[model samples]
Target: MIAANARIGVARSAYFPSLILTGNGGVEAATLADLFKWSSRAFLLGPLAGTALTVPIFDGGRRKGNLERANAIYEEDVALYRQKVLTAFREVEDNLSELRILRDQIKTQGEAVDASSKAQRISSVQYREGAINYLDVIDAQRTVLAAQRAAVQLAGAQAIATVNLVRALGGGWGNATSPDESTQSDKDALTP
Candidate 1:
């Protein structure tokens, strides 16, 4: 800004005062003030502020689509859980029934084994005394072997049923929020 009392001497010649002098200190000051004001208010010139214009996207349709997808997944997870629970109950029921049937079969096999053992003992004695042929002894031995095999098979079936029951009931308890957890959002992100 020019000061009224400030020197305005001309340097065009050794001695010359023909040049006119004028003070523009107030004019310079007003011009600077206007520049500052315009710069300060430039931010309010648009629909959204400058920072808001560049803000991360949050489209309404996109958000709605995401919510719909999440809801579908949550329903599906619930359905899966229901199915698993039903299957587990069915497995337990099936095992109980199978175990009961196998127990009956085992009792019958035990009686057969006992009867075969007695028959073989009698056949052995008769053979030794020459009352029965060796064929009787062979047949008795075969019957005992068959009875033992039957008992073993029944025991195996019982064990298999028990294992299946255990597997059907989820091995252990668990905890977690599935697709139904808090709203699906990018709220944790810095840009959000």
Candidate 2:
């Protein structure tokens, strides 16, 4: 938006006057010996300094075309930027949803791990009292290990979702402004 405005400004400036400066200075001599003699040397200086004002009268619509092109490019960039912002928002929402679901799974998995641990303890006690075979205790321990592994996996998934959410939110936990507000602020910053 700002770039387009600046291009328009430059195009308008073509109608204004520009200041220019010029200068020339040199020395002339008939021979090298005479060049070293101040009386024999002819020097020219401060005789060509002058200023001119230049004004553009016409450009065959070239300036108008350039301004239009710049405006078109600015519009295209704004559209692309808005699309990127929307995509980011969508990703943030998706990751948040995943984190919520994974948290629930982790809670349930924790309960499963606790139950498996208690069952394994009971199985060991029964085996020591000769109420159950060693195989029963070993099976109980396997169940506990599986449950714990599942809980760990769920925790890992939750962490990944959190990281994704942070990335989608531009590496921060703060809420983002609406797209309109963001666009306005960006334009304000870009403007001269």
Candidate 3:
């Protein structure tokens, strides 16, 4: 808003016409008769001459129209800036949503990983006791590996979302020594 007001002030300046002052003086070494003849032309023939004021009397509203156009452009720019800010905020919100969902997915995947590992261990014991074949043990191992991979992928997605959130929020969090400043853990999350 302050910026918009400043732009309006700049546009308003155009209403103030430019002031021009001119003065001319020179000795012509004229005789009395020549002075009378020159004086008939106007005051310029005198020893000293000057225009007290010189300004545009009329421009057919061109200057006013230019100022109006400038104001319109400024308003357009302000609207564009507002739209950009809104888009940025929306992006931040979306990233935050993704992060929240990913956090839950990671937690669920972790549990799946743990359960798969336990199944694999049980299958191994069964194989040793001749209750299950080696193929069953291998299948259990594969399941555990798949679950672990899914958890890792979810974690990676969370990190990417965190980075996106930070970028959407304009990157700067707070002063370096501020309590709410980004910590090493936050920096670590942003790292690839």
Candidate 4:
């Protein structure tokens, strides 16, 4: 954007007077002695030197077009930067929301697993006392197993959400370094 602004300045300057100074220097190489002795005097005696002052007489709106183009480029760059920032913010928000939902899911799933395990234990006791059939105990065992499996899967998903949140935040907290706190090696790693 700064470069684009500088280009705009250059484009605007096209409408102003331009002062151009030009000169050429050459050694008089008629002979080796003349080349060594007359080199200093050759530029003043043999070359043309001049200064030109030029104003934009007529260029058919070229300067105006260039200025407009430069301004457009700068605006485009600013819009692109804004879009990138907005995308980054949206990603962070999404990760945060996912993490929150997964946390609630894991918590509820843990409670469900606990409840199912308790139910299975009670069904086993009933079967042992001959008050319920073995099939009832088996059903309770299957329910407990399914609940435990779901809890484990929810935990896995929670872990995944945590990793994604770290990624959305631009990496793990351990990877961040403030300028004043950074080590020499860290600075060297960032130099490129």
Candidate 2 residue spans exceeding 4 A from truth: 15-55, 172-192
**lDDT digits (tens) for residues 43-152 of candidate 1:** 23233322232332445565456555555666666677789888879988998899899999999999999999999999999999999999999999999999999999
| Tens-digit lDDT track of model 2 for 61-174 | 877787787777778878888899899989989998999899889999999999999999999999999999999999999999999999999988898899899888878646
Instruction: Residues 1-192, candidate 4: write the lDDT tens digits.
Output: 788879888988998998877776666675676766744455532224766779899999898899999999999988988998898899889888988888888889889989999999999999999999999999999999999999899888878878887777778767667767677767789898
Better of 2 and 3 by lDDT: 2
RMSD of 3: 10.6
TM-score of 2: 0.64
Q: Pick the TM-score winner.
A: 4
Which sections of candidate 3 miss by over 4 Å?
Answer: 1-7, 17-52, 172-192
* TM-scores of the models, in the order given: 0.56, 0.64, 0.69, 0.73
Clash tally for model 1: 0
Question: Which candidate's lDDT is highest?
Answer: 4
lDDT per residue for candidate 3 within 144-171, as digits (tens), equals 9999998988988998899889889889
Query: Higher TM-score: candidate 3 or 4?
Result: 4
- The superposed Cα distance between candidate 1 and the true structure at residue 139, in angstroms, equals 0.9
